[model samples]
Structure formats: structure tokens, C-alpha cells
Target chain A: MTRLPGTAKTPGGLYAAPSLVWLSVFFLAPLAIIVAYSFLTPGALGGVEWSPTLDAYRAIANPTFGKVTVNTIIVAMGATAITMLIAIPCGYYMARSEHQNILLMLVMIPFWTNFLIRIYAWIAILGNEGFLNDLLLSLGLVDQSVRFLYNRGAVMLVLVYTYLPYAILPLYSTIDKFDFSLLEAARDLGASKMSAINRVLLPNIRGGVLTAFLFTFIPIFGAYAVPLLVGGTESYMLGNLIADELTKSRDWPLASAISMVITLVTTLGVLLLLRANGTSVLGGDDHEAAEPAGEADALGAAR
Target chain B: MEARKLIDISMNLPHCALRIEDGSDSVAGPVSATGNGLPRGRALQGGIMECGGAKKKTVKGSDVVIEHVRKSFGEFKALDDVSIDIRKGEFFSLLGPSGCGKTTLLRIIAGFEAPEGGSVLLDGQSVLPLPPDARRVNTVFQNYALFPHLSVFENVAFSLRLKRAPEAIVKARVSDYLALVELQAHASKKPSQLSGGQKQRVAIARALINEPSVLLLDEPLSALDAKLRQHMLIELDSIHDKIGITFIYVTHDQQEALSVSDRIAVMNSGAVLQIGTPQEIYEAPATDFVARFIGETNLYEADVTAVSGERVDLLTAEFGAIVVTATNPPPAGSRISWTIRPEKIRIGHTEPRAARDGINVVSGVVAEPIYSGFQSKFYVDTASGAQLKVIKQHADWSDEGPELAWKDDVWLSFSAEDAYIVEVRR
Candidate 1:
């Protein structure tokens, strides 16, 4: 019962070569370029004239970059945290329910109306005298209209509402395999509703939580539009900062440095979690390590 | 002779006064019993049987009583008017095919689903009013339902932690059950690390670790391979004896139910057909449904021509007038079903015994012998075209082997006692 190892050529290896070549060229080369760019020094002439140096990473320790990095992390982490808090239960409810057709339509409804347009729709929603403020004022809930636009709250709200689907989809996939009968076993074991939720439900979904977190978190660090339209100048994430560094300041070198840092940190996050569980928050496309053991195949197929 | 009997001096009367009273007719009208207040009970007008000293089994208590239980989802009836008694510490089974309401019955008993009509009782107390966690029964679900995120030890320790037992006792008890399941080495590893048999054992251990009065198992061994299932039968029997708790095991696997259950309630179309032991269920199923469901059986519709002593002749349209011993005779002129187990129909070389032996035997060509390694079954066809199955014993006929091949003329005989007669509507 010896299975043949793949050959160097033939229809059996039809898919492998193109995939390997494409991955090597597109994926590996870009990461290699980013790594090469990270260790290179920028010329005084204001373009990326490469001189091998660790000065770019050293420049990242500057106070301006540090503050922006911290701010970027704060915004990303906040949005990721908030989105997951909403999406995990949403995903769990969707997974453990029989209303899949309707729920899927609902989950896809946000997708049907365009992603960028969906964010713009939120601008209409959070406008000072828009639907929300007007409804609230007429209902006598607030004496005066509040500043709903150009704020951290607006950014957080749009972040959650916009990337909320991203957080939910990964979690939905994981929760689909969450062994719901295990929850029943817990309840049958005399675990109260809260105890079952905390002891049974939460731990099984931790992988989904981390996945959804990374799905929403890393993307939030690099978001350009949502915070721009929603939060304005105060909530300048690294994506906006990179855009400004490249466009407004005409500083391609610094912009590349920021992009390199973004790529590096995302890789670290992916690597750390993938090292722990062998699957990424975003489906790991680049790992050349041994595949996750055959057990996951049986489990995934069973699910 | 061991020690002379000594009466203690503390037997002196300590009571001061003797009081006697009579109960007045201050009793209110019938209390709201089953939520809707359906008038129930036959009380002695105004009699109150106080529980002081002498215990009454009839009036006082019962275990795992499901009465007038009906449950539905939308328009589909999952359980309808299902009522049964599960005695204390008995290994009872709710056995049926898929969608026949066996698991639903188990769930209703576990308080997972509330029945529409009647109530569920555990130890004379209604559990229908309680949530699943409040009930004194725990369920081991199909696929074991062991926590994949937790180790075997944590899975068993889970209920103890939920009950907030002391750390030392929880550890000791969890270890004891881990040993009981024979997975002490795999205690620290998660469920993903364990095999299917080990997982099911852990699930059973987890359910029983709470020491609930009743344990509900919903096809817990259906996930295992055939060999594992056979192995689990012995393991489950031993565990049942050791735990001494009422196990209400629900499964569609008939052999599993027959092998493990002390009593089985065969359900079909949301109703119990019969409740009996495995042997009783197989050898003498009360209904056609139960008989056919419990094992391989042959059924034929016929009219009883004569009811003689321990034998009757049935005139079947397809098989002509066939005679079989009647353990219980129907009316002389009545349409009845003749059910005979496949193995009970003896296929022999000689002519089957006639009048004195109580019945006529069908003579047919051996249409085919389906060989499945262990046993060769005979599909005999009478000239009248009724195909009857008979399991030819491999052990006896092996030495005289290969004689009963295809197209060999054979006589299938059986005692009238082996055949059962039931009223046939069509």
C-alpha cells in the first residue's frame, strides 16, 4: 500500500508546478522584497536608494512612528475586540440554528450593497442630523443633537459594522464544528446556563475568537477609508499615515518603512498563532511547513 | 453465644400527653396537577395519607414516570401520547428506528425538551417543570460529546467543578472514573487524542460522575466501528452493574439494545409497540411491528380454517392451506398473521412431521443460500410462491457441508409453539 510520491512532471503534477511557481514569484518575492527593503537605508535624495542598513527599523523607534504605531494598535485592537464581542454570538447563533437560508441572506445582504458603499451608508447613518440623531431628538431622548461624526466612537462603530462580517465568517466556520452536543453534555452535567456558556461554549470557540480577532484586527491597522470618513484627523491609523507619508509628504522611503513594519507585525501575528495551532486566522497560504496532521481532515469532513 | 442480648435502659417512655384528633372536611377542590388542571386522581373523598412510618409502594413513589407525554415541532409529531414506567436502577432502552421518537423520548425525560401533553417524573417528582440542569438525570449524547477542548480528566471533572466540589475530592473521583474507563494514561490528553471507544467511555464517566439517579444515553456507541461496538457492549454492562443507576439508553441499533438492555420499549410512529426483555422481544414480540422490528422474521396473511389442539391450519391465498402449531389459537374463522422467526423455521432433508407434530411444513427448492461467512441462510420457496427465510446452522451442517446448495428441494418445519398468531386487518 505504498502511495507514490509526486513526480517532477506529468498530469498528476499538473496543478503543483504552476502553484509553486506562482507562489514563489508573487508571494515569496514580495515578502523577500519587503525584508530587503526593511534592512535598506533610504538616500538623502528622497527616494528608496538602497544601502544595506538597519537604519529603517531604527527609524521606526522614533517617537512619531512609535506614537502612530501605538495609536494604530489601539484602534485595531479595539475594533477587533468589539467586532468579535458582537460577531461570536452572532456566529454561534447562526451556526447552532436552523435558519441558515435566512441568516445567510442576512449575512450576505451587507455584501450585496458594496463594501465601500456600506461604509458610506454608515456616514449617512451617523450624520449629526441623519436618521439616528433625528430619530433620537424626535423621540425626546436627547435635548440636543450629539456629535456622532468625526469621532473615535464613529470609527469604532463603522469598524465593527463594516468588518463585522469578516469577524463572523471565520467564527461561523469554526462554530459549525464546535460539537454542540458537548454543550448539551455540559448542561446535562448540571452546568448552569452561565457555567455552560463560560466553561463549554467559550473554550471551544477560542480558536474562532482568535481567528476573527486577527481577521478584523490586522486589517483595521491598515484601513484607509472607514476612519477617514468616520473619525477624521484624530484617528489616523497607519494606513492613513502611510498614505500621507507617500502622497502628502512625498516620502516614499518612510512610507515603505511603515508598510514594511505593517507586513512584519502581521507576519509575526500569523506565525505566532499558526505556530500554536497550525492554522492561521486568515487561511494560511504561505506556510511551507508540514501540513496540520491528518486528524483535522477527518474532523473537517465530518463537520 | 457471641454476646448475650442486652436491652438498653433508654427505652423508658418520654412522651408526656396522648392527643387524638379527627380531620375535618376543610379540603379544597382538586389542585392544579398537570398545569392545565385536567381532573385527575381517585382520592378517598377526603383522605390524607401522611408519610409517617409504614411506607406504601403503591401510594407513595415511583421512578422515571412519563405520563400522557406528547411533543411536537410545528406540525410534525415527535412524540405522541408516550407513557412508560422505568423502574429504579433498571437499564431501560428507548429503541426505535431513526425519527421514531426514541431519542426525543430520552430528551423529554432528560428535560431537554418539554412534552406537550403530560409530565415526566423522577422519583415521584415532576421534572417537566425544571430545566435540563435542574433534573437529576444526565445524558451521554451520540458521538460521546466529550469536550474536545478539555482533557479526559477535565471532562470527568467538569460536573464536579460545576457543583463546586472541593479540589482534592474532584481530582480523586475523576482519576477513579478515568481508571474505570481504563484511560488513566490518557487522562491529561484532550478528547482529540483519544480513540472513539475511549471517548465514549469518558462520556459515560462524565455523565455518571455527577451520581445522577438516571443516566440517559442517546446512541452513544453509534460512532464506533463494529468491533468497538461489540467491545462496548460488555464494557457498558459492567459499568451499569458498578454504577447501579437507571440507564435509559436510546439507540436505533437493535443488536446493541438487545445485548445491553434489561427492558426495551420498541417505538414506532411515536408510539410504543411493546415493552419487554431482549429475549421476549425477539422470541415473542407482542405485535407484528415489534416482532418484525426486533429481528429477521417472516410474516404472512392468512385465514384460520381450523383451531385444533395446539395447531391450526391457515389458508393463505399465496401459500395455500399451511398448518402450524398454535400456542394460542384464534377464533376458528378469523383472518390472522402467521409470524415465524427465520431461524425458527427448520429446513431439513426428510418430510416434516404431520398431524401428531401439530402442523404442515412447506416443501420448497432452496432458491438461494446467502453466505456471509458465519451462517448460511436459506430462502425457501413453496410451489405457492411464498418465500420463507431460514438460517441454516453452520456448526451442525458444516461436516455434512455443501449439501444444501441452490435448487435443492428442502422441507421447512417448525413447532406451532414457534409460530405466533396476531389479528390481521388486511
Candidate 2:
């Protein structure tokens, strides 16, 4: 298994040699280094040292680190759930109508403006003296000034707004390709409107949902921007802790250890997801993952 | 500016005035341009009226009616003032080339599109305002939008689940339709796991499970290969026979339409140019468009010199003159087209025995011989500077192999009855 795939079998050594060399030099070597670093203790200077220790992983079970992990999961799951809820209906509507280009553009136009700028715009909108508050006060809907920023709710809102386009695009691609005839087929079979959506539409776009979740969830799990800018003491996430370890405290060993632990956890989570769905995470590049019917249907449904 | 161009083009669409099939499964005749007067005495030439056989025969009422339905996409008119009546339980076809609004018309019937100007009726009730589910008609879309996420069994059972039917009944019906499409073994397989033909059958099973009043197919076999299409056609015919539901099948493939539809509605630029049985449409046409579109034909522009009971004498600039006999299409005038089927064109070394029967024959030189296995097509240059198409059956050619060489002068003769004046109102 360690030998280059076709190197031993091939009568012609010419084709096999270059590929084997490239794989060893580029892929296998870097991966080995990463694995070794994950298990090793950091040097007093900066880089990996020779001492083999499980202390890096042991510290991951600490209450503070555990809380960060929990926070990451919640934010990731929250962002994913919110994006799915908003994207599915919007994507479906856009796909069904003849005027899809305009709708698609509406979803994308916000993207042309810088991501940081969009986040800044949100700050203005959510500020106590912001446009929303002003409008509400002018309309006599609110009695006094109200703060909507510097909280988990604010982070969730920004996550939804920032990652919404990503979620919708995958969903739209899957949905746009949907053979509406299947829905009609369902209807002809005595399926009602709600039934058609539930049976046909929902199942078809399951991939888009999972894909949208992964695309948004993974990034938001490590997201620091909206949370940092909007949040204060309580809203500090795993990203802040990693940055604090590496920068504020000048604790390279602890930082590298934290980095290694986070990487492992993420890799494991992804692998578990891929596995539970009967998809092979390993062999993805060499051979395609055999996605189960549900995920395939979901992905295709959204497209 | 582009939007304005689109709106202008859309607003000026012509109407689709096609025949109406009714609840009783019979041609209720077309909604006459004159008004609500049914064919009083002599409308259709034959007793080609009885639509469906046996069982429920309700008062003849149009199942579907479209009046001045028009739609546009960015300056492209998809459906122009299209009006058509699809009879209940009849296999009706909408035939046209690509981008000719045939699918648009089908979508309009299915309530997928709201016609800008016009109303659609299903079972004598107006359905323009109704949603697709409320319209009670199922559509078999061209691209079999089978749920890729679902196993064939689950895809078929989805609608049943939606309707909240008994689990056992859903299982039974799904199994039955799966057996019908010969995909019982593959039912556990998802649409992605199935081949294109298998997916198509699953689509059919899914649509048929609802048993809609009208089953609309938008080029259902367009994706399949020629061989698979042939098999699908047989399966479609059997399914239609067994279910006896109105099949509003749409396709640009003339052969498919001619083979399946009881009556075909030939549409052009949104307007229905002609509607008739496959045989009648191929034989006697109501317009030049119809003559050219339905089958292999030869058309020659001629000046009308005289007219009598169901016959017109025309002077051909190049061939001197010829008398044409035809069924009454409209009031004849000068500058009419003379159309004849390729098979109707006769070529012989010896004089035709029935040449005395006022045969309209013209001298022509064979310019090209195109072999088509069972038949050879001869493209000939007539004295009139027009190319006349002639078909020689392979059996008739013998060892000669339609031996007419290039530029070989030969007399092309046909009985006056074979030549018809094709819809010349000029």
C-alpha cells in the first residue's frame, strides 16, 4: 500500500516514476510532518521538539478549551441552521420563476462589496444610535434606546448575512437543475403542494443543505471577525483563544498544542460525518466517494 | 429598452386556434373564429368523432381551452396568443420546431405559466387562476426530474406519502407501477443509480400514480436514443390504453406525434396552423405550412388560371401549365402553391397507362439520387426551375437501383388528384 499505486504493477517504469516521486515529495512528506507535530512537544524556541507527549491532547480536555469547542459547535450549527432555513425557500423561488437572473443577482450583489465592509455596515445597523433604532424611535415603536450588538445574537445575524450567499448558491445550483416534472409526477399521483415539497423538493435538495451547512459551518466555527468586532468579554471564541495563546501570552508551545488539538477534532468530525453517511473520506482524491442516496439527492435537489 | 422590445413582441402574439376534444372523448370541433356555433351540418368530412371507447361518456365539453395566451422572455415570444382545446382521455399532440412555444403551451395547460391574455379550462372549468395542484393535471417533463436523493421505490411513493395514503396501499401501488415499468429489481436504487431509460420509467410511474385527468408530456422521449424511444413509444401506448387518461403529449418529432396522437395540432409562431388526423394532415392540408411540415413533400409556386368544383388550373411559368385537383381549403386565387407528396411523384420510361386521366406531368432532369435503404430519394430539376422530390421504393428499383443518373431528363407525371393547391389565399 505504501508503494506508488501503479509502480510495482507497471512493466514501464517511465510513467510510474515521476508520479511516485511527486507524491512522496509533496503529499506524503508534508502529511507525515503534520502527524509528527501533532504528537510531539513544541521546542523552547518555536518549532517542533523531540519529546513525544499526549499533553497537547490532554490540555484539549480542559474546561476552558472544552467550552471553546462547545461554542464552536453551537455557532457552526447555528449559522448552518439559519442559512438553510433562509436559503431553501429563497432558492426554490428563484429556481422556479423565469426571472431567476434578477433574483440571483440580488443574492450576489451584496458579495461584490467587501466582506469586512458588509460587516461594518452591520455594525451601523445594529448600533444603539443606528438606523434601525432611529427608525423605530421615529415610528414610536420603541420607548428608549436599545442595544442589539455585542452578543451571540449579533454573531448569529452576521454569520447568516455573510454566509447566506454561499448557502443559497449551492442550493440554487441543485434546485435549478431539478426536473419540475417529478413534482408534477408527484401531484398526478395525488400529492398536494405541501406533499410535493416535502416528498420531492425537500429530499432532492438534501445535498445542498448538507453542503451549505458544511461550507458555512466549518468557516464560522473558526470565524473571529463579526464575533470580535461585535462581541466583548463573553463572546470570545476558540479563534480568540488560539490568537491569545500565540500572540498575547507568547506561549508557542501551548498555541501549537491548541492548533494541533483543534485540527484533530475538526478532522475527526469531518471524517465521522463522511463515514456515518457511508462516504469514504480516505481515497477521495484517488477515487470518488460513493455518497449515499440521501446526500446525493439532497445535493442534487438544491442544484 | 430591451424590456420594451420584449413587451412589444409579447403583446402582438397571434392566437392558437386549434380543435377541441371533449369529455366524451370526441372531436367537439374547433372553437370557430365565427363564434360558439358547433359544426351545424358538415364540419368534419368523416365520422371521425368518437374519441374514447366504452364507459363514461359525458356531455361533450372541452377539457381545456386557451384564448389569446401570450408570454415573452426578454424580447423572445415564447407563446403568442395560443388557444388550444385538449379533449379528455384523448392523445393530443403539440408539434413544432425548437423555441416555437409548444412546450410553453403545455406549461400553460399545466398552470405552470399564466397566459398574459386568455383563460385555460380543465373539465369545462376555468383554470387560469388555479395553482398547478388545483388544476388536477400532471405533467411528464422532458427531462425526467426524478428525485436523485430517493430510491426508485421512495420516489414513486413520495406523492402517496404526501397525500397521506395508507402505507400498505402506497407500497402496493409503487410495487405495481414498478412492475409495470419493469424496474422492480431497481426500485431500491436511487435515480442516480438508474440509467436514463430506467429513470424515465420511474418518472412515468410517479406521474401516473396520481391518475390526473390529463397527463402532459413535454418531449418525454427526447433524451432517449432512437432504439429506446421506439420501446418507450410502445410502453406509452400500452399505458395510455390501460389508463385511458387524456395524454397531452408534446414533441417536435413529427413521427412521434403522428404515431401517438389521435389528432395533431401543428403550431408555428404561437398560432396553430392546422389540426387534423395524421392521415388527413399528411394527405390533405389546410395550409402550405402544413403541407411542408407533416411529411416529405414537393412544393411549386404557380399562378391560378382557372377554378371549378374542388379543382384549380394553374399556369406554371417554367412548365407551361397544369391543372390541380384538391379538397376545398379556402377561396383560391392567383399565386398559390402546388404541393405533392414525394411518393405521389411518378417516373417511368414508358407512358403511364392512366395518363389519359388528366395527369399533370412535367419534364424534369434527375439532379441527385439519395439512397435511404428501403427507398431512394430523387431530387429532380423541373422545366419550371424548381426542384421536385420523388421517392422510389427499393423493391420497385430492381437491379437499376433507381437508375436515374445526374442530369438525366425524365418526365415526372402524376394524376391531377395527387396534386393539390396548398392554402393559397393570395
* The best candidate in terms of TM-score: 1
Tell me the RMSD of model 2 versus the true structure. 10.8
Chain B TM-score, one value per candidate, order as shown: 0.82, 0.82
Candidate 2, B263-284: lDDT as tens digits:
7888887778777666666777
User: Which ten-residue region of model 2 chain B has the weakest summed lDDT?
Assistant: B36-45
TM-score of each: 0.76, 0.75
Off by over 4 Å in 2: A1-72, A86-145, A159-208, A223-229, A241-261, A278-303, B1-62, B192-196, B306-308, B327-335, B395-409
Report lDDT (Cα) of residue B46, candidate 2.
32
DockQ for the candidates, in order: 0.24, 0.20
lDDT per residue as tens, model 1, A92-164 = 8899889966886798788788778888788787788788889999999999887898977788888888889
lDDT of 1 by residue, B1-426 (tens): 111011011111122111112222122334223222111121222343221221111111125888888988888898889889886656788899999999889888887777889988887788888888988888888878887666677788888888788866666667666666777777676677788888898888888777777888899889899999988877886566455557888999898888677678999989888887676677767777887788799987889888778678888876677776656677777887878889887787767545345455778989888987878898888888878889966756444334578899887777667777754554
- Fnat, one value per model: 0.46, 0.28
* Chain A TM-scores of all predicted models: 0.79, 0.76
Query: In candidate 2, what are the lDDT values of residues A1-303, reduced to their tens digit?
Result: 367456667766657778778988998786667666657776665566778887666766779988877777787787779888998888888899889989889999997999899998998998999989998999999998688989888888898899999989988988898877667656555567777888777766666766776788777878878788887656678777878766676545566666666667777887787665444212212211112223222112211
Candidate 1 wrongly placed segments (more than 4 Å): A1-70, A97-102, A105-120, A137-144, A232-303, B1-62, B164-167, B305-329, B352-365, B370-375, B383-385, B394-412, B424-426
